[model samples]
Target: METFSSIECFVRSAEVGSFAEAARRLSLTPAAVGKSVAKLEARLGVRLFQRSTRSLTLTEAGQLFLREVGSSFNTIQNAVANLASAGGQPAGTLKVSMGTAFGRLFVVPLLGEFLRRYPAINPDWHFDNRQVDLIGQGFDAAIGGGFELPQGVVARKLTVAHRVLVASEGYLQNHAAITEPQDLAHHQGILIRSPQTGRVRSWQLTNRNREHSPLMLKARMTMSDSEADCAAAAQGLGIGLVSMPIAIPFLESGGLQRVLPDWYVDDGNISIYYAEHKLLPGKTRAFVDFIIEQFAEQGLAQRFSAV
Candidate 1:
């Protein structure tokens, strides 16, 4: 009974290599976490950690105990999570909404591994550009930028939505030299038409000195979404302004080169929006944690910074 808490505390401490870190994750004071681990050591009749002022290390016995408890605890948790799962098993359908291009490029691919981890949970995902009413529409979560958050709605930011001007290398070779943000108006531009507002979107580009310049480039084509914007630039239709993530692949392959590489538009942040409630359903919570973990591990947030 009480032993489980001590075991969990010990296991967490070992995994993170610090008692303070384990305490923060468990929502307890560091002293409390240390006491719990001390109790576990007393019961097992062995010193588990070799402690120094600046570092913590596991003893041979501690290593053996951790290997044994960590695996068994996970098995126990998954099993108990079935009947008494408190945001654990995530058995029911997890419904989510996200932008078509972003979902297809990022979130959709993570589904395979997420499903593998929680076999009991089913995913129901919607890929669209329009923002969804999470509560009214019965969606567990939605991912995108610029969604108006009504009362009782919350968001967790995934990444900064920094946008850059890009064009195919071929287009750049033939076009007049583009040296700065204001120079964009002289070239063929691909713009995004807002479906909600029905206006060709405009952006204020900024530099390292925090100075802004408004540029309404002449549009040769107006696309509905970022994928099309990137594709248009890749095809040499025009210089397209879009988020770095959407343009990363083309830029990496040398098909598209950044125009005025030092400048970018601050388009706010991409986030996961969910309805806030006292009790979050297991499925929604699982999906949220999974996505956040994936992002952190892969350094997805840092990938799109100006290069």
Candidate 2:
């Protein structure tokens, strides 16, 4: 049991490259994590990490050992969790990552009901507009689109990441009616800057008939957030291309209306991502299932589709 704990400590330290970070994930003190790793090193008679003041680096032998045992250790942990799950209630801090607006608008609304169903489970969610390191960061799950799946991670898609042109009724009334994609060139536009690229995003609108049209409009405003784009459009600044998840509320309240509704830009799928384990944690499985059920019930996939 002690040997297993030491190995887990070592593997976690290797993953995050910091004993302090690993200790946070493990809910242990840094000194305890360091002591466990030292015990493992003494037992194995091989130094695992090169000690440093500012950075932690794995030695050649440490890297080799990590490669050999990391996956195996995870499998053993999953097996143990599986056994525990079979007999125990889903109870723990369920750490998740999601988009800021999407989490607040969509997922947050369901929290009350979710907690009622699983009172023992506590939610610890992070809202950001970027991809998260699920395993290394110790997140139980993440909800977003376009993640490059890590070795032991899997994604369950929730809705299509479809972007549609939207503008306030006042803006549409003031500007010439945009009946076609080419007519958009005569109107003002609220553009979104890609956080990953640091440049304005460019995409072509595609409709049900598979016809494509380039988005060409005067850039009146540019922002990095989708919610900000929706807000700008709602305030009659310009026609903005926004993802359905972020634009739904404004459209619902009649603050914004879809322009050229038949055409949309397909970015990808919004998905809930988690570690791929057969015996997944009860808390994670419960949350994933609940979200999927809610999305299905709301017909989010059909509603989000531009076709």
Candidate 3:
């Protein structure tokens, strides 16, 4: 097995393009870095670098090897940092990006408690509908939905949210009916335009027998905000699809009523994602644990009936 010390020495040398620079960074002698690289090359049976009197360059094998092993190095670093930080008080900035509605409704309300628990943690939050590139944006983490996460990021599923098709009683009273998904094709559907992609949000629904299908409805009105969609639905404009939590308050107030109770859809899980790094900092770890604990306390899994 290749020693971690040797691998780290090689990585630093490759990054700095010189053994002398790498040794300086790692507080080792240039000869020590060179010896580590030689040992690594011998073990792998491949030349990683080609050295000239003036400069050093990676061999073709080295380029490929570094590409494959960079992430592994980062993971190792993060694991070490996480272990070291255990039981230590969190201190530093925790940068997070999240969707506007979720941030406003859920995350914002819980911020006070998190801050009170870890006063040493300073939070920098960005609320938007746009999907952020966490690494490029220098964010520690993000709250997101959907299945396609970017490469080199670790995604942890936090909670599943149910999407319910709802319409005001007044709207249903005037419309033909919405007993089935196909029936929505003829009715005036309030389309939700995603602020991130500028496309009308589509719905996935399952029937009483658990047969699921994606439905694209005809839209008479389109809005970017869920609150606006709910308002329009309440005014008898059309059927609006929204998360269960958002609809619950309105349902109890008699502003909206659930349609086709036997049918439902999943918006997928809310995930906390971060760049796959060698070491997770103290503040980031604290926030991640806090988020998980809060969700657990709220019975987040049970709320969506997620198994």
Candidate 4:
């Protein structure tokens, strides 16, 4: 019989493509991960990994074993999660990945309240503009904007954000008078690169009755950060299409003004996504619920309240 610990270590190493990464994730040393793999190999009497100085590759036998065992390991993990959730005492480390702007403005602030509610649960969060591989990176869940998700992951809607074309009063005043989406082509526009698709993003605008079209603008400057895009617009650098939550404060402060009031853009609901497995750990479940509640109280409830 194979030991669960050894199987878990092997799965992590294979998923991460390195013993060092698996060790880091498991809170163990590289040597320990190597030892566990060696032990598992010895028990099975077959070489599972082709160990090289620069890389780790699964052997033919190992590949077959992984295909068979990975599902079983996931099942065990889910079983554990089910038991923990049933106990109603959520306590564990939850790993989450999110975009820098949304994480800063929304998720990070409400973390304290979550901790206060479930003191035993600890959260490890990573914020970046890049779309990460949740399973490979060993993250429990990810918060993402837009509706498109990678295959095999389950997504729960969190919040809805509207994309709006915004510019500083100074910039609008100095430039040609704006009346329609076509006017954007004549002015300097700030462009945001989509982290997931590696393509330039366009504003999806809808008219008063919700008739929509993608308003393509000429890009004078491109930025990867949404917050920086907002800041540039505020400084009168250029007109930017930004998410509503990020542009709200500037709009309220009169630093940025919405260009097309009658036209609206659907950025889609923000979602909390995770692997579609039966077992979700106690910490992950608690954090998801907490985030849902927080967004509700914050008037962003309709976006993620269904979960």
What TM-score would each prediction reach against the true structure? 0.71, 0.93, 0.70, 0.88
Query: Residue 274 of model 4: what lDDT?
Result: 85
- Model 2: per-residue Cα lDDT over 4-121, one tens digit each: 9999999999989899999998999999999999999999999999989999899999999999998788878876754564237677789999999989988899999999888888
Please, what are the lDDT tens digits per residue for candidate 3 over residues 73-101? 86785666555532566776678998777
Give the poorly placed runs of model 1, Cα more than 4 Å off.
1-88
Top candidate when judged by TM-score against the true structure: 2
Positional deviation of residue 17's Cα in model 3 after best superposition, in angstroms: 18
The whole-model lDDT of each prediction reads: 0.84, 0.89, 0.79, 0.80
Report the Cα lDDT for candidate 2. Answer: 0.89
Which whole-number lDDT from 0 to 100 does residue 152 have in model 3? 71
lDDT of 1 at 302: 92
TM-score-better candidate, 3 vs 4: 4
Candidate numbers, best TM-score first, in rank order: 2, 4, 1, 3
Clashes of each: 0, 0, 6, 2
Worst 10 residues of 1 by lDDT: 77-86
Writing each residue's lDDT as its tens digit, candidate 1 over 49-156 gives 999988889999999999878767755644454455435456866779999888988888898999888888878899988888786555789999887897768999
C-alpha lDDT of candidate 3 relative to the true structure: 0.79
User: Using lDDT as the measure, which candidate wins?
Assistant: 2
